[model samples]
Target: MAKPKAKLETLQDKEILTSELAAIVGKTPQWIRQLTRDKVLNQVSRGKYNLGEAVQAYCEHVSGGKEEEQKPRLIDFKTRYEKTKAEKAELELERIKGNLHAAADVEWLLSDMILTIKTRLLGVPSRVSTECENESADVVESVVRREIETALSAMAKYTPDQIGGDVSHGGPEDS
Candidate 1:
């Protein structure tokens, strides 16, 4: 017995399967599936796409043109993203460590400076008494107060940063 021939339908706007479209476009079925998933090719129905529209969309995509709804590529954060996050965290830790070291050095400098100032202040009256050996107690008191005020005023004129350098920036030699 002879098999009957398949009838050819003359539908104008016929839709085709992704595999059929892929064959027509000379591309793989996977490529066509990707295009559909990317929304580059408009699917008319589930697992079916308008052949004419798909061809037009594919041509536009190939020519660097986009449709009304531009699909953004989804980013996967499990690979390079995790590595970048770790790098940023390490850089932040190093920066914090450097700042801590700078803070410690500044604290040491400030304490040393304060100790020197206090020593000078404590010795001021004795030094003044030697300068005015024969002066009255009242005279000595007045001179000490005036000298202390003048020294404090001079010290007040300098800012903390200005007073903070040691041998490196030519301020004072650190022992």
Candidate 2:
């Protein structure tokens, strides 16, 4: 006598272990577990899944079915914000560069003006000696020294107004 075997149901909708489902979906077993935890994919048992349903659910999630519209808006806003930030940084850098060049130019001009003033002051002793030439050499030397000392003292006390660069006085026509 032969024992008869009962036929199993068809395997199209069969349950599969998580590792098997992951292999079918080309994903890690841990990813299958995460989907089950997030309720994106349903589990058939502690470590099993309905392979067909899991694949469908994962497809829907990856497609961003209900959130597609908002995603583009978020990406666009981030791009615009980064572009504006870069433009503002560039403008600020240009302004700082301009300020540095202007400061350098002002410093150069002031240095040149100071050198010119020093050259004029050095000529004073020769001019004074010539003017007092009728006197004895000792007296002329003493007078020149006294005159130069007086001029140097006056220069030390001089404000920009005395030398012609005062802004507040407006112009020579104002005097």
Candidate 3:
């Protein structure tokens, strides 16, 4: 398939195709289209442009005469960069101050506590089965509850000391 070319309205007209303009301007056709979109270049038709006017516009665009419009964009970029840098620094300081713990450390702490409680609960039946067999129902129940309470009490005495430098990624240290 072939596309129809735009007809020149008059022999005196000075229009050029996108590719011709790009070649003369030392840029890609896409670059020409972008400049046109940015209002730095003008098109005489959908894919044709006035060669002299397009070149003049491109020269003006590259001459820094458009600095006023670009300064806000530059300032905005620098502002965002500084803000992000400050945020990262603040987070780092907070982490070093022991105000935050790594996810891995928290995960380890919970897993350790759960395993301890599970072990304690699993041992209860074996340790109290014979004693419970001879005791009253109330006594048996009290024994089981006491064992569970002891296991739970271990969690109440929570301490981060155990999450020491032993972790693969060094734990937060106290100064």
Candidate 4:
């Protein structure tokens, strides 16, 4: 039988001096003192130190595992979506207000045109044609009215399930 190998003893209370550590690390003792002064290495007892713990701490520092170098947590897409939706809602509200103002102007223009037509029809030279010579205004007004009707029809078309409401609505296309 082969002779039993000698068991190695664990070093629990073993320590090294600052000069010894500097010699092992191939640095000056003054540099070790600077490390201690910078709090990179804690002084356990005067100049004596735990070389194992110091090496481990130095390794961690050089490897960039220091607490201050941790990455910040990132925000997820759902939060970004909610933020964008809120901004879109604000913009939509402004757009609706502007549309309301424009609708008021259109109503005023249409009212004024109807009043002029009524007055002209009531009292005008028989030879003079009261009918508008320019069809562009009528065409524009008709186009606007058609677009508004189409939008309203689109809104009306949504069923309760589609609109998240109670009534079953049909669009012009459905009709």
Model 2: per-residue lDDT, tens digit, 1-175? 9888887755646789999988888899998888888888888778877767777887877665335644554445667899999998887786666532334444444554555557667777787768777778888878767766765665465443233324343323243
RMSD of candidates 1 onward, in order? 11.7, 15.8, 13.8, 17.3
How well does each candidate superpose onto the true structure, as a TM-score? 0.35, 0.34, 0.51, 0.32
lDDT of 4 by residue, 44-100 (tens): 799988867877766664554464535422233456778999998887786666532
lDDT of 4: 0.59
Ranking by TM-score: 3, 1, 2, 4
Question: Which candidate tops TM-score?
Answer: 3
* Prediction-by-prediction clash tally: 0, 0, 0, 0
Checking candidate 1 for backbone clashes, the offending pairs are: none
Query: Once superposed on the true structure, which residue ranges of model 2 sit more than 4 Å away at CA?
Result: 1-11, 66-175
Clashing pairs in 4: none
Q: Per-residue CA lDDT of candidate 1, range 81-163, in tens?
A: 78899998887786566532345556666665576568768888778978778889898888898778866765575454544
| lDDT minimum window of 10 residues, candidate 1 | 70-79
Clashes of 2: 0
What lDDT tens digits, residue by residue, belong to model 3 across residues 39-133? 87878889999877777777767664345753644446677899999999998897788777677677776777787788988888987797688
**What is the lDDT of every predicted structure here?**
0.71, 0.67, 0.77, 0.59
